[model samples]
Each structure stands twice: as C-alpha cells, then as structure tokens.
Target chain A: MIWLTWRQHRKQALFTLIALAVVAAVMVPTGLAMHHRYERSGLAACLADLGDAQMIRQSEAAVHCQALSHQFQQQYSDLAFVAILFVILPVFVGLFFGAPLVAREVEQGTHRLVWTQSVSRRRWALTKFGLVGGVTVVLAVLYAVGVSWWFGPLVTASSGRMGYLSFDVQGVAPVGYTLFAVALGVFAGTLWRKVLPAMGAALVGFAAVRLTVETLARPRYMSPKTLTFSPQSVLRPNPATGDWVYGQGVRDAAGHLVASGAQIGPCAPPGCGGVAAGSYNWQLYQPGSRFWEFQAIETGIFLALTVLLVALAIRRLRDIA
Target chain B: MTTNDQGAHTMELALETGALGKRYGRAWALRDCSLHLPAGRVAALVGPNGAGKTTLLHLAVGLLRPDAGQVRVFGRDPRDDTSVLAEIGFVAQDTPLYRDFTAVDLIRMGGKLNRRWDAPLARDRLASLGIPPDRPVGRLSGGQRAQVALALALAKRPRLLLLDEPIASLDPLARREFMQALMGAVAESGTTVLLSSHLLADLERACDYLIVLQTARVQLVGAVDDLLAQHRTLVGPRSTDTGTPRGVVSVVRARHTDRQSTLLVRRDDDAVIDPAWIEHDVTLEDLVLAYLAEADTRATRTAWEVTA
Candidate 1:
C-alpha cells in the first residue's frame, strides 16, 4: 500500500519537494540578510527597551532607534509583501493533492480495479488518507517552521508577531491551516466523486471557512481588554510591542460611550470640542504576551475542524456505490 | 458425475444470486436478477444498452451493494465477507487503468494490491506482446492498453473474473486480439467468468452460459445447451384453431401470415405437436433475438395501453 501510494503520487511528491526547496532558497538568503541588518543597526536593545518610559526618556542608546526602525521597515517591506504568496501555498496543495486523492480514482474508474483486489475499500481509503495526510501535515510543519524563522527579523522590526498577517505565517497556526485545507479538499472530493468539481468546492469551501474564522471567530476567541487614556494620547497600544489593538474610541468622563473609533473624525453638524471636553480615549486590544495563547487557540480550532472533515470523509467511503 | 464428498452443502457454484436488485435514486437499473452459475463456466451477460448487464456485474463484485437481494460468491456475501473479494478479478468498462502509469507500474500495482498475483505471468504477457513496459498506458495504442489491462486482471489468478464491456470501443482486430489473450490465460486458470456485452456476437464465441436482461429485468438465464433444448420453433396453418400443446410452457414469439403461422415457443421435454405443424431447432442468435423482440413488442404495447 505504501509503495502504491508513493508510486501514484511520486510526481506530486517531487513537485512538493521542489516547491519547498524554492521557498527555502528564497527564505534563507533574505533571512540572513535581514538578521545581519538588524544586528548591525543595534535594534535588539531598542526592541528590549520597548514600552519603558525611563528608557525612552534617558537612555542615549535609544537616540538612533527611531531612524533605524524606520529604515528597517522601508528596506524589508517588499520582502514582506512577497511572503503573502506563502499564504496561498496551502490552497494549491489542498486543490491538487487532496481534492484529487480519491476523486481521480473514481473518475478514472480505477477504484473498481483496486477495490476488487485483496484490499477492502475501507483499508484502501485508510492507507491513502494516512500516507497522504501524514506527509502533508509533516511538510506543512516544516514550512511553518521555516517561515517563522525567516520572518523573525521582520517581526522584531515591526509590531511583533501578533498582528493579522504576521500571525498567519508564523508559529504553529499555519500547520493547522494546512491540515484544514487538505482535509477540506479530501472531504469535498469524496462527496463529489469528481476531480474538477471537488477542486472547485475545495477552493471555495476553504476560502469561506478561512475568511469566516479569521474575520468572525478569531477576534472573539478571547474578549478584548479595555484601556483608558487622557484626552491627549491616541489611545492605541504602542505599535512597537506588536499588540493587536482591536478598537479605539472616545468615552465620557463617567465611562458612558460617546463615539466609536472612526466616527470621531470630521465633525458633522456639531463642533468636535463638544464631545472632546468630557470624553477620554479608550482602546480595546489583546496584549502581545498572548501570542502563543492565540496561536494555540487558533491551531486547536483548525485541528478540530481537520479531524471532523477527515472522519466525515472516511465514513462516506462506505456509501460510495 | 462422481462427486467428492466433503460436507453436506457441497455446492459447486462459483457465483450465485437471489433476485438481486439495484436502483439509482428513483429508477431501477437492475431488479429481480437471479443467477446460479456453476464453477468453470465462461458466462455471457447479454442485453441491450441500459439493460442492467453492467449493474449485475457490479453488484456481484461488491462495487455496488444490492438494494433488494443477496449476491453470493462461493456461498458467501462478497461485501460482508470481503475475503471473497481477493478471489474476484474485475475489468470494468473501457478497462480503466491509470493512464499516467506505465505497463510495468500497473503490473507492480497489481502485485502489491493482490495477494495471489502472478507477477511473472503479467510481465511475460506484456513483454511478449511487444508492449513498451515503461511507456504510459495513455500513450499506448488501444490494443496494447487493452492487452495490458487483461494481463493485470489475469495476473490476479482469481477464481471468478468479471469483465464489463471491455472490448466495446476497440477496433475489430484489437477486439479479437484482446479476447485471444484473455481466453488463453483464462483457459489455464479455469476461472469462472462473466463477461458482459450489449452485442451478443461479441460474447457468443466465448460464453457457454447465457443471461438475458431487458429493461432492468432478467428475461432468461440458463446454460446455453439447456436454453437451446427448452425452446423450439413451429409453423402451422394460420386458420387452425386447435388448442395449444400441454407440455409447452410459454410463447416466446409468434407471427402469423395469410396461409401459415410461425411460433417460437418454450416447452417441456415432451410436447405433442399437431401433425399440421412443422417443428425446427432454434439458433442461439434467433433464440436471443426472439426473446428480445417479444419484450420490445410487449413494452411498446403496454405503453400504449397505459395511455389508452
């Protein structure tokens, strides 16, 4: 079974390996160069001294910190945009490998050939799911590790790693995304029993699940903590620490709501001073310290989805004919 | 026949079914299909298109679960007792091999998939046929691909082999060659075979047992010789109104002209024929066509009856 699976998917495996190598080739050089710049600019101390009022006020080491940070962001911003392409890699893997895994056999009528052999349908499906699913997860883990390492200097230079796109590519979360995408593809393929339609479903279904999860479910995983500031400050957590500031708005002196974040601008039918006199700026954010917590939470959610989709696909195998 | 006594239930049947049925959504693809084929018979499942031949083969091989009745191979349910699966080799319609795989790769796949594969037999067959072992099956000629598929199935060394319209799309030469390769290997193994085709002639040369299906129902099933012996053709004057013979069971077909009547009828062994009637033997092709024609007329007449 292992050899058959390997023989069938050897081409896909080769391409996957090549893709991984290409990603590595791009990552290693850029990562080394970025790390070199970060060290040479002495921004490591600036990172450590973030959010400290005394260091900002008295430390001479922080004199060139602002200029160096701006320079780093300017130099590496293009590379960060290139990393966006990595996000779609899972979608392609899901479409090509997972969607066609079972559907192609049924489409080509090879299932009848194999199912009539010494192997049972359940065993055939199990072995395929085990090998392909296992290898995909393993590859995804390696990919996530590499991307995290490569994105290290970028994260340190900007808003840590807890921000939206940063959080997507870093840590164990991408592994969960990869698993979910592949499982979704397999489940769709099994249900549809056709390669092209299953691929379309996988792509559309994956996008729907990911978009809904990131937009609706992720922010609600833990309630946002509230912070109040005097009328002078912008009321967002300092971007230097990479805290995810969810919302910023004005509140009355008595803590009654006055205006939501963007509504405070361009005063309409009234002077802005009317509300500013009594309202204090309040912000909603998740602390940067919760990075791993969020990663664990998101990964756990996607992993659970992966397991559910796989189990459904396996159960559907009995009803193929 | 001197039977070897092993146990009380010593049936020699390789494939048997009891009123098996299947449906797709609301419409029946096959229904009321009953077959009892003894071991070592090369049976032909013959019918028109959409006559449920493929459905019956699929049901017997566990590719489809019967909606209504039982399908047993060697006295065991194939789906329930999947050990029976290893003994059944099936080549589905168009002989679907992985188009991207080489002939060698397919042989390797067969070896890995079946416990009783004859790997050397497969290799020898393909090599002797001058098939390029490393070329993808899709790139091969239709004849070569069909031969490769036959070799793969034959390599399994199965007790029961089911083939579904395997040579339907092939050219005449390719079709004959495919059958030759199949028969040569099958003769050595003595496998119980059920090969299906809508055209009777395609399977008539290879099959000894006949099962006729029309409109998702089995019209006739028996050994070729038995069916031949049970049916007869009679011609008599059209004006004669004498009662039918006692031993004749049913009228399979009938035609009348101004002066004479021709009747294709099924009968018991001893049917007393009127002296005015002339009796003749039925050819296999005529026998099959007569039965098929009878059903087509009845179906058309019934459709009109419903509207009327």
Candidate 2:
C-alpha cells in the first residue's frame, strides 16, 4: 500500500521538487545580492552612526554625520521577505499533499476496488490519511525551520518586532495557521469529490479568512500609537490625559477632541478635569503580556480544529460506496 | 453423501439457490430464482433483455445481497463467506479492467489478490491466443481486452467460473476464439463454468446445462440433453384429454388449434398417441421459447384477489 501510494504521487512529488528547486534557486541569488549590499560602505556607515546617536546627543558638537547604507535596506528587505515566504507556504502544501489525496481516488472510482477488498473502509481511510497527514506535518515543520534559518540573521537584528512586519518567527501562529489551512484543503477536497473545484474552494476560503483576520482581527490583537508630552513642574500629570491613539490625525474634522487614543483625566465638569489636558501624541498600548500564552493556546485550538476536519473526512469516506 | 437404494448418477454441485429473491422498491428483479448447477459442468443462463439473468449471476457471485432466501456457491453462503469468492472467478459484463494497466500488470494484480494464481498457464495462454501483454489495456480492442480479462480470471484457477456476457461485444470470429479458449481452459482444468448471455448460439456451442428465466423467474432449469429429450410440442384436434398427459413430465404450454389442441409437454417418449390428435417433436429453441412465452402470458394475467 505504501509503495502504491508513493507510485501514485510520483507526479506530485516531481512537481514539488521542481517548485522547491525554483525557490532555492531564486533565494540563493537574492541572498548573495543581500550579502554583497551589507558588506558595502554606505549601508555599513548607517549602522556605525546608529550607535553614535546617544554619544552625539550629550556632546552638542556638530559631528560628522554618517548615512544609513545599502546594508540596512538589504536587512530590512530580508526581514520583510520571511513573512511573504510563509504566507504562500500553505498554498504549496495544499497543491502537493492535499489536492489529489482523496478526491482523485473518488474521481477515478478506484476506491471501489479498494473498499471491496479485504481491508475495511475505516482502516483504508485511516491508512491513507495517517500516511499523508504525517507527511504534511513533517513537511510543514521543515518549511518552518527553513524560513527561520533563511531569515534568522535579519529577525534577530530587528528583534521579535519583525513579526509585526509579517514574517517573523516570533510565535507559533505561523505553524498553526499553515497546518489548519492544509487540513482544511483536504477536507474541502474530500467533500467536493473533485480536484479543481476543491482547490478553488480552498484558495477562496483561505484568502477570505486571511483578509478578515488581518483587517478586522488585528485591531483587537494590539493597538499601537505614538505620543509626546512634557511633565509638570512638580510631578507627573494625570496619565489619562495621554490616551494612546492608534492612527495618525485621528481627531475629528473641527478638531475639538480626539475620539480615539489613550488618555487620563479627572471626572469633574470644566474644573481640574478639563484643564486643557496638556496635548500630547498618543500611542496605543502594545500587548506586552501573554504573547507565548496566546501562541500556545491558539496553536492547540487550530491543531484541534484540523484534527476534527480530518476525522470528518475519514468518516465520510466510508459511505463512498 | 450417498442416499437410499438408488443408482442415480450424482455429481458434486458447484452452485445452488434456494428460493433466492431480490427486490428494488416495488419491483422484484429476481423472485424465487432457485437453481442448481453440478460441479464440472457448464450452465448457460439465458433470458431476454430486462430479464433477471444478470441479477441472478450477481446474487450467485455475492456481489448483490438477496432480499429474501439464500444463494449458495459450493454449498456455502456467498454473502457471509469470502471463501466462496475465492473459489469463484467472475467476469463482469463489459470487462471492467483498469485502463492504465497493461495485461502483465493486470495479471500481477490478480496474482497478488488471489491465493491460487496460475501465472505460467496465464502467460502461456495469452501467448497462444496471440495477445500482446505489454500494451496498455485501454489501447487494446474490445475483443483483445475480453481475452485479457479472461486470462486474468482464469489465472486464479477458480473452481467455478461465472461470466456475464463474456463475448457480447466481440465479432463472430473473436467470439468463437474466446469460446474456444474458454472451452480449452475448462477441459484442461475441469473448472465448473456458469455464463449468462443473450446470444443463444454462443451458449449452444459452449454450455451443457441450461436455465431459462423470464419476468424475473426461472422458467426451466436442467441438463441440455435431458431438457431437449423430455420436452415436446404435441398438436392435435379438440377431442383430447386436458389433465397431465401420459408419458409426460410436465405440461409446459398448451393451446387449442382449429378443431385441434396443441400441447407442449416435457416427455421423452413419443407425444401422446391419441388417434384424434397429432404430436410433433420440439426443438431446443422452440422448447425455450414456449416456456418464455408461457411465462410472459402468466405474468400479465395472474392478478391478485383482494379479500374484504
């Protein structure tokens, strides 16, 4: 059975190999260009000057200013590239492992022969799913490791903040997301009983969920803002007066008051409460706590959902007769 | 397994159906299709289109479950026993072979699936039949594919071979060749064969036992020679006895001719010699036709009476 499966997937395996080779081929030249730019002079000088900012602030002398170099841009691009790599990982995994796995069998009607053989339908479904599912997980993990390695230098330089930029290996979110999407593709394929339609459904579904999460869910994940304000003569003013607003120029048209932004003020009417609350630039409060906690919890959630969908797929295969 | 005080010739039976029946919704496809085929003999299952020939074959092969009664292959219930399937080689109608596989690949799959595979015999037979094994099955002509399918089934060395229209699509020459190959296989292996076909000529050439079905019922089942010798169509005048006639097995069909009565009876001796009537010998085709015609008439006119 294992040999038969391998033989059946030979074409898919070849396609995956070609795709990976292309990616590796493109990445090598890109990596070389990046290495070259980082070693050049202008970019090198920017890093050298970044540390000198503290030194120059205290001295008050017009020091020789160094420009940010090509190396900095290269590093920035490298950091951004990691996210792009992972966003498309699920698509590749779905194409190779999920698309034809069950749908092809049902479409070809070869499943009837297998179903009527000595093996029970449940065992048959489980064997195929287990074999393919194990391979998919392993491949996903390998891809995650590759993404981490290829962008490790850039990520560490930018700290975990690279995650906010899209492709950072900050938490377990990427792994969970890819596994969920691949399993969802398999479920769709099984339900649809055809290859092209199932692939289309998976693509549309993945895109919709991703867009919704990025646009709608992001605001709830964290609210970031920037604010600048001076301290009082004796002590700090009320913290509520410095509400951290998330976006730029968020004040209403007449500019009477800012509807969004974090601020603190007294509750009285027109007294010390509204003492022209010293104007300040507001930055939304960043979620500093529970990062790993959320990662672990959401990882479990997505993985559990994946297992459930796969179980449904297996159960449905029994009635294919 | 001997019985009382009789020197009757007995043979080991290959297949038996005891009041077998199947129904789909309101219609019955096979009702009380009881039959028996002794081992090492070929049985031809004959019926017109829409008759229960294929349904009976499917029931016998365990591919279909009977709604009532039972079907036994080699004295074992086919539904519950995979052992029965192992002993039977079934060639389904239209030859369902994997298109991507070559003849060699099909035989290899058969070898893996069946416990007893005569690989050498299959290869040699293909060679003798002038069939190329390396070509894909889809590329082969219908006749060639049928031959390949036959080889696959025969390689199993089954005790009983059940075929459904094994040569319906073949040209006359290919059909003859297929029958010749099947006959050679059976003669060499002593395999019991049961085939259902609408083509009477092919059945005439290859089969020894006969079963005729009409309107989802078995009209007649017996040895070919015995059936031919016992059944006769007797035509006479109206002054004839209507009850069971002398030297008669059964009154299969009877009708009143112009001032005469024609009776089709299953009797070996000369048709009843009444000076007032005329008797004639019955051909196998005429004998089978009379039963079919009678069965059709009975089905249409037999109405159920409702009681208050």
Candidate 3:
C-alpha cells in the first residue's frame, strides 16, 4: 500500500519539490547577502540589546541608527515582498495535491476498480490520506523552517519575531496551515466527488477560515494585557517591550469608558471625558514574550480542525458507492 | 457439505444475498435481490439498462452497502471481513483502470494489494497477447485496455470473479477474445464467475447459469439447460384468451391477433397438448424478452389497480 501510494502521487511530489527548490534558489542568495549586510550596515547598532528589544533612546547616535534601519529596509524590500508570498504555498497544496487526492479517483470511476481489491476501503483511504498528508506537512515544516532562518536576522533586528508580519512564516503554524488546507481539500473532494469543484471549495474555505482565525480569534487567544495612564502626567511609557498593541481607549475620571481606538472625536458633552477630567489613556497588547505560546495555540487549533476534516472524509468515503 | 440424492460432491455457495436492497434517494437501484451463486459455475446476469445489474455486482463486492438486507460471500460479509475481499476479484463497468498507469505499474500494484498475486501469470498472459507491458493504459486501444484489466483480475487468483459490463464497450472481435481469455483463465482455476452483460450472445457461449433481472428484481434464475427445457412457446387460435393454457406453471407472455394467439409458458411437467396447438422450444433471447415484457406489464397492472 505504501509503495502504491508513492507511485500514485510521485508526480505531484516531484513538482512540489521542484517548486521548493526554485524558492530556495531565490531565497538562498538574498538571505546570505542580507546576513552579510546585517552587521556591516550597522542595523544591529540600532537595538538597545541583542534581543532587538528597544531602541537606544539616550544615545546621540540614535538618529544615525534609525537611518541605518531605514536603509536596510529599503535594500531588502524585494525579499520582504517574497517573504509575504510564503502563505500561498499552502493554498496551492490545498488546491492541487489535496483536492484531487480522492476526487479524481471517484470522478474517473476508478474508486470502483481499486476498492474491489484485497484491501479494505478503510485501509486504502487512510493509507492514501496518511501518506499524502504526512509528506505535505513535513515538507511544509521544512519550508517554514527555511523561511524562518532566512528571515531570522531581519526579524530579530526589527521587533524580535513577535510581529504579525513575521509570525506566520517563522513557526510551526505553516505545518498546521498546510495540513488543514490538505484535509479541507480531501473533505471537499469526498463531499463533492469532483476535482474542480472540490478545489474551488477548498480554496474558498481555506481562505475564509484562515481570515476568520487571523482577524477574529487570534488577538483573543489570550486576553490582551492592559496598560493605563492619567492624561495630565503622561510619562514616556514603555509597556511590555516590543508588545503588539491591539487597541487603545480613554476612561473618564470615574473610570467609565468614553472613547476608544481610532473612533475618538472631540468629547461632544464638553467635560464628559479627556484631559479636563483626568481621564487615562489605556492600551491593550499581547506581550512579546508570549510569541511561542501564541504559535502553539494557533497550531493546536488548526491541528484539531484538520483531524476533524480527515475523520469526516473517511466517513464520507464509506458511502461513496 | 450437503448433497443431493445422487451423492456427488456438492460445491459450496460462493455468493449469497438475502432480501438485498439498495436505494439512491427515492429510487430503488436494487430491490430484494436475494441470490444464490454456487461455486464452479459461470452465471450470466442479464438485464437491460437500469435493471440493477451493476448494483447487484457492486453489492456483492462490498463497493456498495445494501440498504435493506445483507450479502455474504463465502459466508462472510465483504464489508466487515477483509479476508473475504482477497477471494473475490471484480472488474467493474467499463473496466475502469488508472489511465496513467503502465501495465507494469498496475501489475506491481496488484502484487502489493493481493496476497495471491500471480505476477508471472499476468506478465506472460499480456506478453503472449503482444501487449507492451510498459505502455500507459490510456494509450492502449479499448481491447488492449480490457485485456490488461482482465489480466489484473486474473492475477489475483480469486476463488470468485464478478464482472459488470466489462465487455459492453468492446467491438465484436475484442469481445470474443476477452471472453476467451476470461474462460481460459477461469477454467484453469475453477473460479466461480458472475458476469453482468446486456450482450446476450457473448454470455450465451461463456456462461452455464443464467439470472435475469427486471424492475429491480430477479425475474428468473436457473441452470441454462433447465431453463431452456422448462420454457416453451405455444401457438394456437385466439380462443384461449379466457385464461392461461392448461399445464402452464405460469404465463410468461401472451400475444393475440384476429384468429391466433402466441404464448410463452413455464412448465416442469410433461403434459399433452391439444391437436389445434403447436409447440416450439424457446431460445434464450426469447425467454429473456418474454420475462422482461411480462414483468413490465405486471408492474403496470399493479400500478393501475391502486389508481383504479
């Protein structure tokens, strides 16, 4: 069964490997050059510590360090653009590799041929999904690791790899995304029994769930920690260093919320809130130190969802006839 | 181990179904399709399109689960018993093979999937037929592809083989050759075969047992020689339209004109015929058509009674 699965999917595997190789060809040279320039261009000097935690505020060369950071950003802007395209790999995996996995067999009427063999339908379905899905995720993890390494110097030199811009490509999340996408494709394929429609459904479904997770569920994975301040004696506040600021609001003297985020207009009722009432400005953020925790949470959510889809696909396969 | 009075060695039942049924939404693909297929006999499942032939074969192979009843192959359910799957090889409708797989690839796949795969038998058979083992099946002609499918099934060395319309798409010469290869292989292994086909001539020569299905049910099933002997066509004056003729077990079909009537009847007893009538042996095709037409009319009569 294992050998047969390889024979069936070796073409798709080869194409993916070649695509990975091409991406490597592009990332390797630029990544090496970017590393060479990280220290030589003095972007490292802008950070207060090796952690890229805070800017060297008291130094006279702070202005010079900002200039170096801006220069490095401009020089590597092309690589940054490519780095953002990394998520599209999982989408392709969903559409091409996963969508057609069982769908093409049913469409071509070949399920009747193979299911009549000595293997039980359950064994055949599980083996195919297991092999194809296992390889797809392993390759995705390797790609994610490569991208993380390539982006290491750049992210650590900026915001310590905790920002949304670098979080998705640098951790175990890619494996989850790839796995979920493939399993979603398999489920769609089994449900629809046609390859093209399954691919379309998988793409739309993957995008919708990914967007919903990223925008709606992600910020609240853990409750945002809050920082509050009085308006009159506002000090240069450094909350958790390099924290992701989620939202900001103002509270009145009595601690009733008056305005929030970017929706604040001048207080209509003249003394309802603001500096006149000693209202404090409050900011919400996920501390940068919880980066690994966030990655594990997101990956676990996607993994649970992937397992559900795989189970549904297997159940659907029994009724295919 | 039970035997008839003759005490000859009795073959076991290779396949059996009891009140087997399958439905697709509102329509019944197969209804109460209980069957008994004894080992060591090649049976033909004769039915027109939409007559549930494929449904029966699919249920037998466990590709389909019965909605109302159960199917047992060698006294074990195909769906629950994976070991029974090794003993039942099937070639599905149109002989669906992986289009991109070469014969060698498929042969290798068969070797991996089946415990009793005869690799050299598959290879030698294809080689003897001048088939190139390395060419993709999609590139092969219809005849060549069907041959490859047969080879794959035969290599499994199954005790029973179920084929659904495997030769339906082949030309005359290819159809004959396909059956010849199938018969030759089955003869060597003494495998029980239940083949479903609309082409009566092909099945007539290859099969010894016959099962005719109509309206999603089995219309008639028996050994070929017995079926041929048990049915007869009688021609007489139209006056007999009052009811069925004497000694007929049942009226299969009746056609009447101004002065004459023709009737197909089933009878196991030897009875005297009136001098006014003449009897003739019914051909297999006529026997099938009579039962089919009779079933259609019976269905209409039942439907009309409810409305009336």
Candidate 4:
C-alpha cells in the first residue's frame, strides 16, 4: 500500500521538491549576503545590546542602523514573490496534489478498481492521506525554515515576526496550515467527486478559514496583556520584542474608557476631563514572549481541523458505492 | 462437504443473495434480488440497460452495501468480511485503468496491494498478449486495456471473479478477443465467474448458468440447459377461455392471431401432454427476451392499474 501510494504521488512530490530547491537556491545566497552586511556594519551587536531605547537615544548609531536596515529591506524586497508564494503555497498543494488525489480516481472511474483490492477502503484512504499529508507537512516545514532563515535579520531588526504575514510564513504554523489545506482538499474532492470543482472548493475554504483565524481567532488565543502609561512617559511597547498591539484607548482617573483623541481634563463633567495629564493611554497587546504559545494554539486548531476533515473523508469513502 | 445419494459432493455456492436491495435516492436499483451461483460455473447476468445487473455485481464484490437484506459470497457477508475481499476479483463496467501509469506500473501496484498477487503470471499474460510493459495504459487500445484489467484481476488468484459488463464498450473483434483471454484464465484457474452483459448473444457461448434481471428483480435464475429445457412454446387454437396448463410454472408471454394462439410457458414438471397443443424447445435468447418483455408488460400494467 505504501509503495502504491508513493508511485501514485511521486510526480507531485518530485515537483514540490524541485520548487523548494529553486526557492532555496534564490534565498540562500541573499540570506548570506544580508547576514554579511549586518555583521560588517556592526548593526547586529548594536541592535542586540543597545535595545530600542538606546538605539533611539544615540542618533549616530541609530542613523547607521537605519541605513543598514534600509539596505537589508531593499535587497529583500526583490524576494517579495517568495513571500507571496509562501502565502499561496498551501492552496497550490491543495489544488494540484490533494484535490486530485481522490477526485481523479472517482472521475476516471478507477475508485472501483482500487477499492476492490484486498486492502480495505479505510486502509487505502489512510495510506494515501498519511503518505501525501506527511510529505506536505515536511515540505511546509522546510519552506518555513528557509523563509525564517532568509528573513531572520529583518525580523530581528524590525520585530515583524508577530504580524500576519511573518506569523503565517514562520515557525510551525505553516506546517499546520499545509496539513489543513491538504485535508480540506481531500474532503472537498471526496464530497464533490470532481477535480475542478473540488479544487475551487478547497481554495475558497482554505482562504475563508485562514482569514477567519487570522482576523478573529488568533489575537484572542490568550487574553492580551494591557499596559497603561501617562502621555508624557517614554515607556512604549517595544517593537523590537515583536509584541502585537491590538488596540489603544484613553482612560480617565476614574478608569472610564474614553475614545482616543478625546479631550481630557482633571475636573470636568463625566463626559470630559479637565486635565490631559490625569488621563492615561492603555494598549492591549500580545507580548513577543508568547509567540510560541500562540503558535502552539494556532497549530493545534489547524491540526484538529485536519484530523476532522481526514476522518470525514474516510467516512465518506464507505458510502462511495 | 455433504454428499448426495448419488455419491457426488454437493456443490458449494460461490455467491448467494437473499432479498438484496439497493437504492439511489428514491428509486431502487435492485430490489429483493435473490440468486445463487454454484461454484466453478460461469454465470451470466443478463438484464436491460438499467435492470440492476451492475448493482448486483457490485453488491457481490462488496463495492456496494445492500440497502436491505444481504449479499453473501462463499457463505459470508462480503461487505462485513475483510477476508472475503481476497477471494473475489472484479472488473467494473468501464474497465478503468490509470491512464498515466505504464502497464508494468499497474502490475507493480497490484503486487503491492494484494498479499497473494502473482506477479509472474501477470507479466507472462501481458507478454503473451503482445502488450509492451513500459507503454502507458492510455496509449493502449480498448482491447489491450481490457486485457490488462483482466490480467490484474486474474493474477489475484481469486476464488470468484465478478465482471460487470466487461466487454460492453469494445468492438466485435475486441470483444471476442477479450472474452477469449478471460475464458483462458478462467479455465486455467477454475474460478467461479459472474459476468454481466445486456447483450444476450455474448453469453450464449461463455456462460453455463444464467440469471435474468429486470425491473430491479431477478426474473429468472437457473442452469442454461435446464432453463432452455423447462420453457416450452405451445401453439394451439385461439380461445378466450383457454386455461393455463397444470404443469406450467408461469405463462411468460402470449400471442394471439385471428385463428391460433402461441403461449410461452415455464414447465414445472413433465405431465400428460395436451394432444391439441404443440410444444417446442426455447432458445436461450428467446427465453431471456420473453422474461424481459414480460417484466416490462407487468410494470406497465401496474402503472395503468394504479391510474385506473
């Protein structure tokens, strides 16, 4: 069964490997060059120790770091296609590889051939999903590693890892995304029993789920930490730490939440504050230290979805007759 | 094995269905279709275009579960028993083959999936048929693809081989060639075969046991010789009050001319002959068409009665 699955899917697997190798070919040299430039300009040590405040205080050092960061961003900008590709890679996998897995068999009328073999339908489905889904997860991890390496300097310098784009392309979350996309494709193929429609359904479903998770579910994984500070204070959430600030609001001395940009006075009616200094601005954020925790939660959600879709696909096979 | 009084062992049944039924939405594809095919006999499943032949064959191979009652192969419910799968080989109607795969690739796939796959036999069969191993199945002719499908099933060494309209789409020459290869394999392995086809002429030379299905029901099931021998066409004078003969199982069809009547009847037992009537042996084609025609008349009559 394993051999059969491999034979059936080796073409797609080989294509995926070549695509990854091409990505690596483009990313490796540029990544090394960026690292070299960072080292030569001494921005690595400067950014590592001085932190955001010290860097901001020393204008000369800040200027040099800013110039190096600009150079890094400009050089990396040419590889924007890679980022866009990473974002859509799972959809491609679902369309080309996963959607056609079962749908093609059914469309070509070969399900009857394979389903009648000595192996049961459940084993057949499991072996196909296990081998193909396993390869997809591995490739996605490799891609995540490659992108993380290539963009490591930018992420460190700008504290951009917690944003939507970087978060989707880094760490173990991409692996979960790939698994979920593949499972969705398989489920759609089994349900629709046609290749083109299955591919369309998978793409739409993956996009919907991804958008929902990013917008609605991800920030709420853990209750964000809130911090309040007076307007004159220099204390702000450090971007260098990759903390995600969800929202900010102004609050009066009585702790009533007020709209940002509203007037604040010390002694006034309930709707207004007489003194601006008496009010504080509070920011809701997820700290950079919770990156892994968020990754775990997001990955868990996707993997759970993967399991459910795969199980549904297998159960659907029982009724194929 | 139990023995009869004649000292011959009672034949084991390769497939048996009791009140088996299948439904696609509201309409039944097969209903109360009970049949028995004794082991080692090549049984022909004859039916019209939508007459449940494919459904019955699918049910036997465990590709389909019966909506009601059960289908048993070798005395076990095929849908519930994993062991039963190894004993049955099926070639579905379309003769589906992976168009992207080479002949050898399909054979290798078979070897990987079937525990008892006979790789050498598959290779030898393909070679003898002049099929190149490395050629993709898509490039092969319809006859060649059918041969490859048959070889794959035959190499499984299954005890029962179920073929659902295996030659329906082939040309006359290709059909003959496919059947020839199939019979060669069956003869060598002594496999019990259940082959479905709407073409009655194709079954005349290939099948020993005959099953006729129509209106989602088993219209007739018997040995070919017994079925032909038991059905007689009687010619007699036309009479409105003519009663059915005592020994007749059923009146299959009746045709009336101005002066005479011709009736086809299934005989239950040989009885004293009515001197006025003439009896003639029925051919396999005539018997099958009679049953199919009878089923259609009965269906239309029921529809008319309901409206009236």
Ranking by DockQ: 3, 4, 1, 2
Alpha carbon lDDT at B112, candidate 4? 82
Which number leads on DockQ? 3
Predicted candidate 3 versus true structure: per-residue lDDT over B1-308, tens digit per residue: 11221221255788888999999999998898877788888999998889999999988898888999999898889884668888988898888898989999999999888888899999999999999888899999999999999899888889889988989999989998999999999998999999998768789988888999988999988778778888889898886555667777777888888999998888646665555667899999999999988888887887788531
Decoy 4 TM-score against native: 0.91
Model 1, docking class: medium
**Tens digits of per-residue lDDT for model 1, A85-174:** 877788888898899988999888888777878888888888998898899889888989888888888887776788878888889988
Better of 2 and 3 by lDDT: 3
TM-score of chain B of each: 0.92, 0.89, 0.93, 0.94
Q: What is the lDDT of residue B44 in candidate 1?
A: 89
Write the residue-wise lDDT of candidate 1 on B163-219 in tens digits: 998889899998898888888888888999999988898888888888888888888
Per-residue lDDT tens digits of candidate 2, residues B131-219?
88898787999898888878877887889998888899999999988999899889988999999888677888678888999889998
What tens-digit string does per-residue lDDT give for candidate 2 at A20-84? 78867766676555555554634334334334221123111122212232235454664475567
Between candidates 2 and 3, which one is better according to DockQ?
3
Clashing pairs in model 4, backbone N/Cα/C closer than 3 A: A264-A273, A265-A273, A265-A274, A265-A275, A266-A274, A266-A275
What is each candidate's DockQ, to 2 decimals?
Answer: 0.68, 0.15, 0.78, 0.75
TM-score of chain A of each: 0.87, 0.68, 0.85, 0.86
- What is the number of backbone collisions in each predicted candidate, taken in the order shown? 1, 22, 0, 6
Q: What is the lDDT of residue B144 in candidate 4?
A: 91
